[model samples]
Target: ADLSQKSHRYVRSEPGGPPGKDVYSLLRCRVLLGRPYLIEGNLLAPNALHDFLLCDDPTDALETVAEDWVTTGHDAFYVRGLQRSAKSERGVYNSEYIVFHAWQALPLYRVDYTLE
Candidate 1:
């Protein structure tokens, strides 16, 4: 549960600044040990980030809603790296979700990275 290595970015919507003004924050974190652990307490709350459940492989049957509100309207917040499931029939598998609020924040349409 140590988030020391994690990096975060915060953005606030301007203009009228309505109640609960759409605020967005990006957190980059890694789990030394892979598993589905709860990262944020509340997904729809302000300054909340998503949980990440890392897995060795991917699953197919799991239907993922890329645009779910829990993803904070960020396409980068959805599940990834799921190509096989060890416990496919048992329905027990590993995954991760970038949890966030989506009401006021603009959608995260894309993510780009160059491997080192």
Candidate 2:
């Protein structure tokens, strides 16, 4: 299964506007999904959030795409049916994709989320 397809499933947030102002100084939030994830690392050096990177390289980051829709290079569904062994294995398969990114995008709407 394409775990990436399940995109924001791991964000794990309850309904809310955000944490208190103190949270801003104590924790950093994840982009796309509003979760208070990493703590503010060493203040001695600037740009400490780099230490909380989920991936080593930004190139590893995939282009933004709909989570429910099939990935750019992958078919939505083909593993549904196992082929028959008696005859030439051939069942029916059709790929389908439903867009779910809208649900993820709305939270970050026109709101300003600056760390003030």
* Backbone clashes, each candidate: 6, 0
Give candidate 2 misplaced runs (Cα > 4 Å). 1-35, 38-42, 51-116
Give a tens-digit lDDT track for model 1, residues 64-116.
Answer: 33322432222333233332542333221233354333432444443322212
Candidate 1: Cα lDDT at 102: 43
lDDT of 2 by residue, 2-61 (tens): 232233332333334366522111112222332211111112233322343231221122
Task: Give the clashing residue pairs of candidate 2, or none.
Answer: none
